[model samples]
Target: MFLSMSFRLRTEVEALNMVEAMGAYSRHRTVSLLKPRGDGKGYRLVIAPAVSGQAIAFGYMKSLVELAQQKNLPICDQCRNYESKGGFVKHGTDTSGDLENLVRSCIVEDVTGFMIAKAEVRRTSAIQFSYMTPDIDSSDVAIDPQFHVRAAKPGEKPQPFQVESGTAIYVLGVALDIDKIGVVPDSNGKPKIVVANRAERVKTAIQAIAHLLEGLSFGAKKARYLPVYDVVGAVAAISHPVPFMVSPARISKDMDYVTKTVLRASNYVKLFSDAKETIKLFYMDKENVVGEVKAENIDITKADNVSELVLKIIEVIEKSLRD
Candidate 1:
């Protein structure tokens, strides 16, 4: 069943900036915000749906492949620094091509130029996220001035460092086609089984997404802080494709209403499936987390079970993670 997941991300000081121009006058420093649809200016946080989907795919694949890429170390297996330690393997699939195959199928290889050529586009990413708009009206937003001191070397002079901070309840609605991807037995019997099925593929992709998004930091000064998501998603009782993006206004915070809206919307589109929303919270750090986001929150780290939930939500469509 195709399922839609939508939720509010209440972020604090998520430092996002797409700089068009720069100057030494810190007060004049500009940060991008979501402009209305017809406006010409682009916003970094309120991203385009297509780009968001690709970014999701990239995030997911990057999470899945990082270990192998790190251990494999060098690009071009021919590099002299490369020793044939036979350690460049993920889950026993030691070959680089195998890893590349999985990555290219779902994500873009823009992580690096070498990965770009190798990671040719395969199955288009099924996850579609809408332009994440703030739940509250833009006029209600309050921007606070952040002040800092520029650390200068002996040869340089100091300057003022100021940035504006804004907080909003942003909403993102995503539709995932879980019925399309599944895991089937490997033709070559390597790595035990293949994750190419639509159900399995979607599961893997979502898991990757959950991993990437957890403790995600973006824009400038990424090290300072991260965004937190009060996430919710619904799975259908049957295979109903949520192909369209519903705006935040039309969405209901109530879980039942959310499910019904999805059902009705799908029916109108002549698509049929049942789904329900499961609620959870996601955060960045595992320790000292002084913020309000709880540690008990799901999908906290790479080690979390967030990935398995994808399969759980699609149990009506496919029961097995590996088949």
Candidate 2:
């Protein structure tokens, strides 16, 4: 069974990945839209699944180490030997390599790993996520204008240039699958446990996703704030394996669709309690978090008390686990 997570996204002037300058007419160069296909044309609406997955993985690994220390777990001195003159542990094992290093048998990089085998490179990733699909009216997308000022050198005035900025409102649907991925075969060709301490590793990752996204800026400029508003999720289990995608047209503040999705997921969980994975839908609206939902879960109560994004995410994750 494949566990899935669906979510929403709203961005403002956050150039995630920059494309080549469209036309360097003005001094300030313009970044293409999310798609960035041609000189000025590709009306990209969604954040690529690859980019989002990398971001999530990076944050998850980073937070895993920090959280481990907070919990008083013994961290390897070699792993923490980050300040040595050795260039990125030139005299040490790659800390980023999940299998090569260890934190109480927990891979710092979690389920993602790299190995060189018989002159052939092998890589593995357990958690997978999909591109965030947007729900905006295509006609509503238009090229907008923004200004950038070059730093003045010596006696030169700060050159001001006009770069084309894109303004878009999209409703995104994202999917996540947390199943165990490929395993490495050991001597005699038996699958060894390449992924160590999975439950703890995954828990840390989920915590990072919930708390770190707002504080850590993704995609483009960090100087300018990229707005992330009202992010939430609908997590549950699944019965029959089926590909699910939400229409972009339903990306409004309305919770009707979201409610139905949650109910469906709940039904699926009830029907398929023995299934290996669950279903998750992450929507970016608070209006849907209604009706005794929080009242039913104590973890959610704590989340509500703190109003932290991480807690809110935990609420959804815990709900999914229970289902």
Candidate maximizing lDDT: 2
Provide the TM-score for each candidate, comma-separated: 0.51, 0.56
Off by over 4 Å in 2: 1-3, 21-108, 115-121, 137-143, 155-157, 162-198, 225-228, 232-256, 259-284, 287-323
Model 1 over residues 1-323: C-alpha lDDT tens digits?
A: 44555544555554443232445422212324444443435533542111133333334445545432543322233222123533222222222344344433322221211222343423333455554445543323345657776788899988766655545555555665544333222567442323333343444445544555453421334455343444333221222333443324223223332334444454444432233322222212122212232222121111123334444554433453345
Please give, for residues 122-240, the per-residue lDDT of candidate 2 as tens digits: 34544444333333433244344467677999989987765444444433333333433223455687755444444454455555444434444333444553444444433322223
- Candidate 1: RMSD to truth: 10.8
Model 1 alpha-carbon miss at residue 230, Å: 4.4
Return the top candidate by TM-score.
Answer: 2
* Cα TM-score of candidate 2: 0.56
